[model samples]
Target: MLVVEQLRKSFPTAQGPLPVLQGVDLCLARGSSLALMGESGSGKSTLLHLLAGLDCADSGSILIDGEPLDGRSESALARWRREGIGLVFQHYNLISSLNVAANLAFQARLAGRHDPQWLDYLTQQLGLMPLLQRYPEQLSGGQQQRVAIGRALAARPALLLADEPTGSLDEASSDEVLALMLQLVGEAGSSVLLVTHSPRLAARLQRRCVLHAGRVQAGPV
Candidate 1:
């Protein structure tokens, strides 16, 4: 469902243009999960941003189900971000003002793809039914992360982009959250591109690749 080809990106520095992603290429099939593993400063997050259209690649192509995500206008990129992908971050970027119910449905509502039944199912499966009325500030880190995952999947997006999504939680919490995410993602038939540092966590995904010197290298999971 996702294809990236010769993806290159560089950042401007006072000295020169520092290259981040140099001819990176990878692919993830429909309903499959891929773990992106790399050391610090290997550009995993940068790759994710480029794929999400939050940042542009200097040269390359990113295709989701044959739809190109490169060189689009800001508005078009915004629409793509809303309609095509779901993002989960380690910070749990929840709307503090909205309660759990609103936060859980926020992305779906934004994408104009809200499915009440699906939202309800996610809520129940994530064990969030009891916290529906509570605010983010009132919940634990695990609870907040669950809400974030629900919000991401609420739209049934074609791809889910997660960047160290369980980094802030304990091992038990992380395992629970990831298990739930994989379960729901499978049910939704969405592809996954997860950026993680833990080999144990990466091992749980369908495949794993390491980023080295700004390129993808197939390796042991």
Candidate 2:
């Protein structure tokens, strides 16, 4: 489960401090999914980063399963991120030097949760079995994105944060990848907070929240 209370973040600008998120509050139950929809600059990605501990909130608390992340040291946060969070970005930030197989197993190995059977299952499910030996540059956009998703889920982290994961793919590929991701996340029993701009994509999830005026609208999702 994930919880956010009065989450506020501001970035320094030439003019002054520009607030992105102000007093935002949201929660997602364990094993559930929530789609975070917002326009550009609505702080969707900022919120996701805070949840992943990639960035610190100016003020507020982010709790994962009742553990607060506010006061953790960088070393502690890094360990927590490696072990507890799975992140998928739009760019498919794969290691170009590593082949698909290595990339798929990278995070799981780092988390010390590597399972060959599970990795094989993920490869099969993501339609990536044949491309395992290829590097990131050799695969199509969809294939590469699939590998990214596979890598994120390979470790079976408690929470998955996907930031516009399908933004680079065509509609058909986007639909395919998103559907597969949801199915696999369910199988892995991990909570998901997917940030996307598409209503069609957001609607597919069990719950949806729209960010506006620096805070999340609606209640529990």
Candidate 3:
């Protein structure tokens, strides 16, 4: 489970500091999913990054299964990110030199949780068995994203965070990828917090919240 309370963040700007998040609060139960929706400049991605520990919140706290997330050393945060969180972004971010199989196992191995059987199952579930030998460049955007999702789940992370994960794909492909992701996340029994602007996509999740003026509220749209 994840809990965020009064989360606040600001960034440097020519016009003094521009605040992005102001007392934002959210919670996601284990094995559940929530969609974060917001317009441009609404601080959705900022909150996601904070949760991932890629960036820190200037105020407030993030808790994963009751463990505090703020104020950790860089090394500790890095370790937590590698072993406890599974992240997917708009970009596939795959290693160009690595084949699909290697790409999928990369993070899992880093987390010291690699399971060949689970990897194989993921490959099968993602319809990627035949593409295991192929590289990122050889696949379409949808294929590459599936590989990204597989790689994230390969680590068996307790929580999964996706930021605009289907942003690059066509509408049909987006739906397909989202469905597949939810299915696999269910199979893995991992909680998911997906950041997306699409209401349709947001509605597909079990719950939805909107980020407005730096705070989280029940989705209005």
Query: Compared with the true structure, what per-residue lDDT tens digits does model 3 show for residues 1-221?
Result: 78999999999999999999999999999999999988999998888889888998888999988989998899999998999989999998999999999999999999999999999999999999999999999999999999999999998899999999999999999999999999999999999999998988999999998899989888643
lDDT of 3: 0.93
Candidate 2 displacement at residue 148 in angstroms: 0.4
Each prediction's TM-score versus the true structure = 0.98, 0.98, 0.97
Whole-model Cα lDDT per candidate? 0.94, 0.93, 0.93
- What is the overall TM-score of model 2 with all chains considered together? 0.98
lDDT of 1 by residue, 5-115 (tens): 999999999999999999999999999999999999999999999989988899989987787888678999998899889999999999999999999999999999999
- Regions of candidate 2 where Cα sits further than 4 Å from its true position: 219-221
Task: Point out where model 3 deviates above 4 Å.
Answer: none
Question: How much does candidate 1 score in TM-score?
Answer: 0.98
Candidate number that wins on lDDT, 1 or 2: 1
Per-prediction CA RMSD (Å): 0.9, 1.2, 1.2
